[model samples]
Target: MKTPLTSFAGLDLLTSAVIVLDAEGSILFANASAENLLDSSFKSLTHLKLTDLFLNGEELIEVFHQAVAHQFADKRQDLTLERAGREALHVHSIVTALDNPDTPVLIELRENVQQLKLDREERMLDQSKANKELIRNLAHEIKNPLGGIRGAAQLLELELPERHLRELREYTQVIIKEADRLQTLVDRLLAPHRLPHIVGDVNIHEVCERVRSLIVAEFPQGLTIKRDYDLSIPEFRGDKEQLIQTVLNIAHNAAQALHERIRQGDAVLTFKSRVVRQITLAKVRYRLALDLHIIDNGPGIPPEIRNRIFYPLVSGKEGGSGLGLTLAQTFVEQHLGVIECESRPEYTDFRILIPLP
Candidate 1:
């Protein structure tokens, strides 16, 4: 006999999609989350088998069979779920055997972002806190001594009247120039923090377009910027110019890294935007958020500095000040967002996640 539908009433409260099935893989019950995830009403879903909802579900079927045979829990990752007339979903799922014979297997489905979102959010938050404290303390220490050193050099230069010590004036000029350079560096470090966010409705695609145009204009010859935007994304409150600067910083770095590929006329930079659901950023869970990906075909980030790319003054490129990514991070954080990167040789993906109201 089949399990009664009302037996799994308590499962409706679960956020993760869940289904209860008999030993033969026919679904006995699906929770509210399962309904939402599968985009089908429970009444309609009741007529379908569990494995029928997926494409290439042979492994998933085996997982279910094993769970039923051994009465143990089985875990699987990166399972593709096929939806009729809709894009497929990549999911991670777990199957567990039930004590009841009528409903022998319990399957829980977790969308791929559950763990990835938490891991990246935690990493970016910790890194941002450390970077902020370091920048603040370092800037304060440098600024105090910096002003005095520049002032003293100016006085010493003037006092060494163009007479016998004229050549010595060159030394004073060097000191003043170096001090000024250091001061400028300190200012740049503090620039992101100093500016107040001018919050307004910000269309992320607009920002992307601006950055794309600027990059194309700068490169002009060898790079192609492709757009894959989800027009349904609504505008949210943010500083438009800051967001623009943030994207430009990341895109500019990518373009610079793609110099060899660009020279060969095969460079590609893709700006893909989509709406992600239930993402966590900086310890806060958001129901909806924007995920903007800047994907590039380049030599990839140097492995040595890849971990510290967001740290101030840590640049992998020749003559790079290394402040670009740092500033970019600060700007994104100001908008309550986080940027995460994954890279390999000839491919790089940078994902920016910001909550939506």
Candidate 2:
């Protein structure tokens, strides 16, 4: 006679990770992906409690309890899973109560990094489109009246009577100057949209090197820029100049944020590159992707603006134009990639993932 495990053999063939739990939260079954994800065989996993596998197990356990009590499906995003002697796994988890009272909960987990990236990219693209429309409309509205205002100021300056106009000319000059400044701001806002995306074979290390050289030259005194490159990453098709600027913007921001650390001679910035396999970007899966990280030992991004850092005109730094990250994100997205950030008290990390051909 076949055992109960044979009845659910179909679940083992699924790519997504699945785990079944009894009413007491003990593992009843785990699929193949669950085995690989939890770093344990089905036989071993069955002996463990479901909570034993998650870093935030208590919270998940509560979710299981709630699901059982309410008899409803519950879901959590970006849940961290605990494993022995390994990095925590990030997954999206769904818990559903089983009809059988013996096995009361079913858990489904999927690796969430790529899905999160894809969702973020979609949101960014939508936001970027909206911003472009707003900028175009606002630019036109401001630009039309701006030229008239500047011209009027110039004509007033030219028509001023010499004796009475000396001090008054300064007023006209101020108007022209402020108008010119606003014009420059508008131009910068429109620059990314105006540029042609010129594609070519891109060596990521070369981009990193160029950005490093620029940063070091600017902050030569107390900053150290380190390279942790995986030389195995191959050249891919992209816009070299755009990539250079993207890396430069991130490095430049890190350098600026390291002001105190730079003064203390302890500023450290690292450029790390590796090849990520089987990653998805904007809902498209790629066999390989270039994972580039720019990390810094600085004060980290301010908490208030962390969520909106990628939004246009949002800046953490005083007097920052706030377009650097916006442009960087735009350029990367053009290459079918996404950028993400994680920050805390003493560390800040910016990661850019671009799908490889």
Top candidate on lDDT is 1
lDDT of 1 by residue, 117-211 (tens): 66557777888889999999999999999889989988887778667477898798899999989999999988888988899999999999999
TM-score, per-candidate, Cα-based = 0.69, 0.72
- RMSD in angstroms, candidate 1? 12.0
RMSD of each: 12.0, 9.8
Tell me how candidate 2 scores on lDDT.
0.87
Q: Clash number for every model?
A: 0, 0
Model 2 scores worst on lDDT over the 10 consecutive residues at 1-10
| Candidate 1 clash pair list | none
With candidate 1 superimposed using the best TM-score fit, by how many Å does residue 221's alpha carbon deviate from the native?
0.4
Top model number, TM-score: 2
Output the TM-score of candidate 1: 0.69
